[model samples]
Target: MTPSNPDPDPYLTPGYRPGGATLPRETPPGETPPAEGGTSFTGPDDSHNPTDGWAAAPLTAVLVVAALVVAFFVAYAVWFVID
Candidate 1:
């Protein structure tokens, strides 16, 4: 009789398995993957859009007040130097 086979990788021999490993089932052509398996978005699509007016009003008011304070100081210094 001939010698028996020692290596049994499925890739090497079509009908053989090295240690009885199971292969994943094949998907049919043109079929979409199941909902739980498909790719998904991780965050909101409109995350860059501006917020509502109520949330932005306070920041606008603060910037306007800061600009007025700076303009007042600059005007006072110029007048004092010129007088």
Candidate 2:
């Protein structure tokens, strides 16, 4: 039989076998994986979730209008007081 080449079978020949246990089958212990239905979803169900501090366009428009009104009144008061 031809010699078994060390290059072809490194693990079988000597001290080169893999060192650790096989990787975990499921997530490691205490890992609290996504809720338990094999569906694996972890967050709110809504697909179009709004961010915490984000506002929609209509709300932003209202805020801008209100700010402009307040600014106009403040500027009018300053002008009236000066004149």
Candidate 3:
């Protein structure tokens, strides 16, 4: 009996043994594995906004105007006041 050459025989191992019966299936090219971690669907909460309806707009406007008024008065006192 002749020994099977593993290099030329797909069914033979090195000396003369059969290889693994199941070969890996051929996967189509360009296919990637799924993402490891699950995806998330969320956004910032609406509580950050401190306004409601027309009242909210006017309230924000009033606060901005008040800040500007205070800034102008402070500048006048610091630079324009008689020394």
The TM-score values for the models, in the order shown, are 0.34, 0.34, 0.31
Q: Whole-model lDDT, candidate 1?
A: 0.67
Once fitted onto the true fold, the runs of candidate 3 whose alpha carbons sit more than 4 angstroms away are 1-54, 81-83
Model 2 TM-score, all chains together: 0.34
- At residue 74, candidate 2 shows an lDDT of 100
Runs in model 2 deviating more than 4 A are: 1-55
RMSD of 2: 15.4
Query: Candidate 1: RMSD over Cα atoms?
Result: 12.5
What would the per-residue lDDT of candidate 3 be over residues 18-39, giving only the tens digit for each residue? 4444433433333335556754
**2-75: candidate 1 lDDT, tens digit per residue:** 99878674465333345664444333333434457445775578758675666667888999999999999999
Local distance difference test values of all predictions, in order:
0.67, 0.67, 0.62
